[model samples]
Target: MTDPLLTETREDEKTAAWWRQAAVYQIYPRSFADANGDGLGDIPGIVSRVDYLAQLGIDAVWLSPFYPSALADGGYDVADYRDVDPRLGTLEDFDAMVAALHERGIRVVVDIVPNHTSDLHEWFQEALAAGRGSDARERYIFRDGEGPDGAEPPTDWGAAFGGPAWERVEDGQWYLHSFATEQPDLNWDHPEVRADFLKTLRFWSDRGVDGFRIDVAHMLTKDLTEPLPSRAELELLDRSSGRHPLADRDEVHEIYAEWRKVFNEYDPPRTAVAEAWVETPERRAKYASAEGLGQAFNFDLLVADFDADQFLRIIADNLEQARATGSSTTWVLSNHDVTRHATRYGLAPLAGRPVKQGVEWVAAGGPEDELDRARGARRANAATLLLLGLPGSTYLYQGEELGLHEVAAISAEQRQDPSFFRGASFDGLGRDGCRVPLPWTASGSSFGFGADGAHLPQPAWFAEHAVDVEAADPSSTLSLYRDALRLRHLLQAEEALVWTDTGRADVLRFARPNGWEIVTNFGEEPFDLAADAANVVLSSLALDGQLLPGEATAWIAPA
Candidate 1:
């Protein structure tokens, strides 16, 4: 019996690096499978699931931050960079998990939060204990208040989460924090700060970790001498022509360049990917240049509307930038930070804003304007097919294979995201909707995420999309992913994508070198396939005869 989902192209023996064509899975450790009866997922829980990941056909797993912290920002606030939080596991547990992943041919990439550290970090604690002018205070961005008697904040910069960026201590000195007040920004200008991160990087690299995913990579260097920009100015700054005073500074590249030397010291040469939120493709390219971090996430595709023209423009622009920098383009649909693509696709498109910026706006839409779940699922499946066919490494957030949508109804009291607590100025509802634990079993406490209740409440609907239920149904989204991934090697050919003219403005048709054609319909109506495209290998939705439905994508091979 031939599998309908499998492609005919044979796996190639190309000598390209693993990351260039790899399908990396992103795991938010706290929301993945939990092994112990504890409500939260742990390192051991991840180890127990290595077989599951291996079966899914992913080449690598990028674990979100698990370092010891107060969980002020979903573990992004790190108190200790060298060890796992006791709540998560010990250092020994981490090593064992890494060993388990490596044994299964899956590489490990851990998150490194270099821009800031938790207020409880020993360095920050010591800085507070020491006087304002002490060497201990130099590690972080702490300064005397600007006004008389040192009362006013040093700058007017606002926190990324919300409120003022500066927080005053008992001593009347103000400290800078781009995120939550509990997560203070580190002073990269200090030599000790650079040395400390180098040591931290080596600690993980020596433990055989494959790579690092840098958090807030562009905001590392800030010009303390300059006054902070106004909120309006800051919002405009991301798109403005000038360099930002607090982000994407020219000096930030120097830090990565130095780190590149550390990365090269390893045998296969460890790599780093930056999470830069710069405006233009040219600015993004600089972060992924030879002298800087090897790769930076290109999120234009993630935020673009579900239109053929928008998709083509973003794809072309990213490819062009990647080519100029000699960096592999990275494509991702969803992650822990934003609303899941499934839910995002369900909402009506916002006129003037990109999808990423319209989450709060979507949330504001009343229950009368509820999500079109069926449409969202179909579009998500098509999007994944489109993403996998693109010519670069791809990232899949956990549970996306299960077709999970954002649990938007999570109560405010149950929400854990720091941003939610910060108020409407920060666009409040928070990212908790997308970080709910994966539903493993159709019937179990917390759907088999653990014996105990999940850290974040899982909506009752999760039972229908549980792994066990999906695994039993061949037509489920999970099955589609498994089959698509098993045959993804067909997309590994190092050739440029050739656009095919479908004679319709609303349909996007492109072909790879292997005679594999991908057609996606963005119009409001079904599209009739050409005679040669009748041999369909995969379709996001069941076809209506030879017609491809709107918001659907299909992979077809030559007859």
Candidate 2:
């Protein structure tokens, strides 16, 4: 395909607003690459890999949290938002990394965690020391107990990581923490708390960062005066429905609107992508409104199964919602939090049913256990093509290009996620499976991830999917990503997506305005594409003559 979209030299349109229709790569700093041989990936290590990212044809990089943290929630418990973690690198190193990325025409989007702060943070520490009813305590959500002697908690709210959301201080006051106890929720009702975050936003933006990925974007405001919902009601508050006391409230949008004002003050205007897990598409659209953050993650497709009907419905819903709000839709597959799609697609139950709820772990032995690694990989590749071919922006998680599978066998002693430790039933099975360090080379210590062993142990089978190993083979997953991403930039820039009825119920066929067609076969049987397809641009797997195999995707021009 020729560069049809680049024919117009609209220099005035070309500015820092490059996020629209961009392919952004998410980098989990601890697991990306280790330059200093310290077994942990750092900013300098990421700096070393800039050329690799440029070669992959990504427009931007969204880095996960790397602030000064206790690592209680894997850097989500941020102690200091202004500086880089000593383990990761210094602030100087962060500046160098950003400069290198910008030089390569890649934008940098850092993770901004405004919902909570580490208990070890100076403000949180002062709140604890200043005792109850003090000004310091006002920075966080601190409330007195309801019962006699203040023995009972304020309410029956539950934490996302597993226990009671309220933890009592030595002064007999309970503070709310929606996640881990080490991370106390910030009191957005306080003007000082809001000002501090505004300063934090400016601090990074002043350092030349292009944008931010707001963590827990829907979780800043809470009606602390209202009685907490019952445990049953809380359980009803999944990703899709039900209104909670603390999440997706109308007040949260006000905060983002203020942030948006600050974002616009910059040249070309810094953009923010919200990590809001709101219920309905309408509610999600509110977070991405003109006054709000401008982009919110549309996770409907991520929660869907590999079925054609479910995929089409989610895509249509997302695009419609984005259009309603005048914002671009954001598509994502795997991230640091969820189970990798490579493993999720292999589980037998997901083959027939839609994955509405988040997946934690798949049982090892069951009568209907149908965990096929090869099949899962094939589906993952197909799904990537489908995601990229869509009409808006896409986010790619680290190590996905190598087609890495979930390392579900990590032992109990090596496990680090707070979710695993908090829930009895979730023991030995947490997010550590997907957070394993990347394998750069096929051999050497930690698969060349570092000089020493990785922070999270790499599985023995990781060698098979190492970057050096895959780069040499043309048919490897890494090559597929390179080819797909390069072609995606050329073909998807100015195209409009129109769904096509392939007549087969199990097939999803969509056509683009640029004479490109995409067909994905989710059915058990092979799909004959000889009649509909002219020249094959790409295929997730080797096609049997002119037949697209089951669990595969093909890109072609119309016959």
- Candidate that would win on lDDT: 2
Candidate 1 C-alpha error for residue 112, in Å: 0.7
TM-score of 1: 0.93
The digit string of per-residue lDDT tens for model 1 on 266-343 reads 877787889999877788888888677888998876666677898877777777677677778899889988768877
TM-score to native of every candidate shown: 0.93, 0.93
Task: Note the clash tally of each candidate.
Answer: 0, 0
lDDT of 2 by residue, 400-464 (tens): 99999887666768878998788722323668878999999989889988889899888888999
> What's the CA error at residue 213 for candidate 1, in Å?
0.8
Candidate 1 minimal-lDDT segment of 10 residues: 1-10
Tell me the spans in candidate 1 whose CA falls farther than 4 Å from its real position.
1-16, 226-243, 352-368, 424-426
